[model samples]
Target: MLKRLFKLGLIINPYSGIGGALALKGSDGADIRQQALIRGAEKLSGKRMAIALQALLPLKNELSIYTASGEMGEDILSSMGFNHVVVYQHQAQQTESADTKAAALELIAQAVDLILFAGGDGTARNICEVVENHCPVVGVPAGCKIHSGVYAITPKAAGQVVAQVIKGELVSLMSGEVKDIDETEFRAGRVIAKHYGEMLVPEELRYIQAVKMGGKESDELVLSDIAAHVIELMDDEPDTLFVMGSGSTVDSIMQELGLSNTLLGVDLVRGQQLLANDLTAASLLEHCANKPVKIVLTLIGGQGHILGRGNQQLSPELVKMVSKQNILVVATKSKLQSLQGRPLVSDSGDTTLDEMLVGPIPVITGFHDLVLYSVGSM
Candidate 1:
């Protein structure tokens, strides 16, 4: 009798994170990808896929892999010495969302037990379009805005979840959301995140990221109090450069200071004066350099992410520039209570920084009020 091998499907969006570091803000269009490449951005989806696949090395002989041809899948699997069958061939040199959907359909046809893909929310949307609830999938976080619940908190965690499934361990299945935002509105400092649909995913609370909570803060009184406290601080430190992060909580502060805020983008202010609006990563680094900078941030409602969800503008370099002590977090008491005691997450894509950020930090809940909370990364 022969052992029945665990069959796994793989798909890599080779251009997923190409526009992130370059400040293009998304990898959705071919023209955007070309712009990023011309500006010297390298495709990092393959490298991210490689990191996730590392954990499956020991179980190689006990598994069978299926994937798309070339950079979409085969290249990385081949480099990693995993024997895989190319189930679909991409028609164009540059892979599109259509390629991802086609590859997923082929994988379902092959009856793979689980599909593991690397990309952001856009990639998740493509997979959901074809697979729906037909097959389970795991996503590696490798895009500009990872505002979806389908992705693992980190690349290594993604592999670990897949490994559990491959080892025949008890991994629960649940519906993961496929959410995306209009890049046009996003670039214009507006966040209109909408739920496209859902897909069956292997559930691991420690590994899987939570879906980003949408809508605005409804407690007008609490928002006003929180905003007042932040304004008081700004008055006390007249010389400090304030970097306003995204979220309604921070936006409330901007409103109190009598300044227009970028609803879904980073802004800059000094002594209650608006200096800049909707800055990119490079712009942030240049402006924040050699200044006494303090970053005003707020956690994502249900996700508890203070960094690396939609605020990719706060790149690792910019975070380091401001230092951890200079970060001021504000959220309503009810908002913090909604997490039910899950620590805040800082999935900044830099393992070292994420580790460095682990500890208790102060959160301003109201006027002259603060509470200590823990921050962690998967």
Candidate 2:
């Protein structure tokens, strides 16, 4: 059905997204991978690659893929019956970020038409370091916290983009930011994201996502209304443990309650008292044991995500302990509208929990103002 015979480059960060379900926050370097596995984390990026490659199968005869051996890319592409050449070989026992960089360098040396990689922001950074603006690239969203604009909205969307690229349908190239968060601070329930660099991504407005937004805004009237509503609810249940998530909107409620809250971390509040400040996953679990708990979260502006972005401290296990009904979501009208009517996303790393969070969820926008918004997997 397509006539173009392009040299496509494929690379996979086999250890990408491994730290997600384990609640390790960010998956970078070999030590993280080993720790993730010890904590029972499974391989996800390879399966994500399989999903994207399936979509490009129809172009098998017309595409020549250059990739690394084994889990990087060759295994999946070869099994899919696509013509591929192994450009790099990994050490097998130790595949680090250097392996990814080597693969990208070899792919660039081959002068591939397009490079497709499966990982989170870290993998994007590795590829961007070597192939910046030299060739078009697309990222498959398969990480714990994806703050990069290089990733597609979903893996299926990434597949669609890859197919279109092979068909020569997408012609625009736009710069996408590659960001990385401080893993040490992240595991401690503090979010510190920094922009590493940028990469050229195939521009298809439908598939690309926006970079994470930061900073604060003060809306005294509206924030006061939202804070009053939340305070009233907290007052009704004196014994319930309230887990507060980060963001300016949520911070407003904490300020009104006269309790200290983390501006970029998760905190625990119970009956007008600050029980914990910037609690880690293990610490939250330990404190919440045998206690009735509720989670209060705020949406990320522009990106409709209430979980799995910067609040990795509220791990999947901790969320399951609280359940969805006990979760409180509060956001401003402008923040909700910024999503353009899309449901909020949760990449909490636990697939079953993500599914359980699906369907229409209630969000408190203002004083007694409620909206039932759908929740989908990212």
Candidate 3:
């Protein structure tokens, strides 16, 4: 007897994370994508999709893939030697939101069991516009701003979820929120997220990412204490270069140090003074060459992600150069409690670095306060 084939649909937003490494905040508008290209930013949606598709390789004979042509899907499937049919075709050089919507509709028409897409929140919103709750979808995190709950914690994790479904495992379906922020406000260091709608996603608590929590930490005293402790560390290690990451928690620390900060971008500080503002991955490497460096980061509210959410500027190369020991995580105790016992995730896009980042790490919760938390790559 022959085994039934698992029909899977794939969509890759070729320009999804184009603006991340360049510090443009998002790849929303065509103008922003163009600017990112001009600044030498490479589109990583395909690469991220490839990561998610790796786990499906062993089951290729029992799988059938339906996707769009060229960079959106066909190219990747071809390169990976997967059997795929192009249900939709578009100009590979310039794909747009309309293409994504059309592809979603085509996939639905084909009655695919699942639609796996790679991009950030904007891509999720695009799919939500057409598919709604009509089809089950899985998101591969490959965007600059991933505030939606539909995506997996990482690309590889997305593949694992799909693999479970292929093997006829009991995968529960849940409505995942599709959220997106205004790029204009985001570039200005203000986050204005709005709920677009929901989609049916495979429920895997350990794999799926939670919706990003909006607003600042309301506990001013806790933030003050955390800020004071970071300031003390800065004073003790005056010669050490501190790479300040994004988030309200880290911004509060910068406020306490009386230094201007790029709230949504990485900043470099030394001797209690801001060395550079909004440095890209390459620029960060250039500036921190052969210097004693420590990276200070904060968790992404409900998500519990210390890396690979929005701070793509901290490339895997930079993370490796600085080493895990030099990383400092700051979060309020209340913030940590909001996770409901989920381990912090490190989806740095490098599987090896993410694995190396695993294990117990200390988080600064208050002034002279530290809590041990386990970090994992899901």
| TM-scores, all models, native as reference | 0.55, 0.53, 0.54
Question: Which of candidates 1 and 3 is the stronger one according to lDDT?
Answer: 3
- Model 3 residue runs over 4 Å out of place are 205-378
Error of 3 at 258 (Å): 66
Residue range 1-378, candidate 1, lDDT tens digits: 244567799999999989999888899999999899889999999999999999999999987999999999999999999999999999899999999999999998886767899998899999999998666789999999998888999999999988876664434456688999999899999999999998767754221221114433447877787788888888999998999999988998898888999989999999999999999999999998998999999999998999998788999998888877688899876687788777789999997777667654557776755555557546
Best-matching candidate per lDDT: 3
- Candidate 1 or 2, higher lDDT? 1
lDDT of 3 by residue, 143-235 (tens): 999999999999999999888767654344566899999999988989899999998787532212221245344477778888888889889
lDDT of 1: 0.84
The models' CA-based lDDT, in order, is: 0.84, 0.79, 0.85
Relative to the true structure, candidate 3 reaches a TM of 0.54
Q: Rank the candidates by TM-score, best first.
A: 1, 3, 2
List residue ranges in candidate 1 displaced over 4 A: 205-378
- Cα lDDT for residue 183, candidate 1: 92
Determine which window of 10 residues in candidate 2 has minimal summed lDDT: 205-214
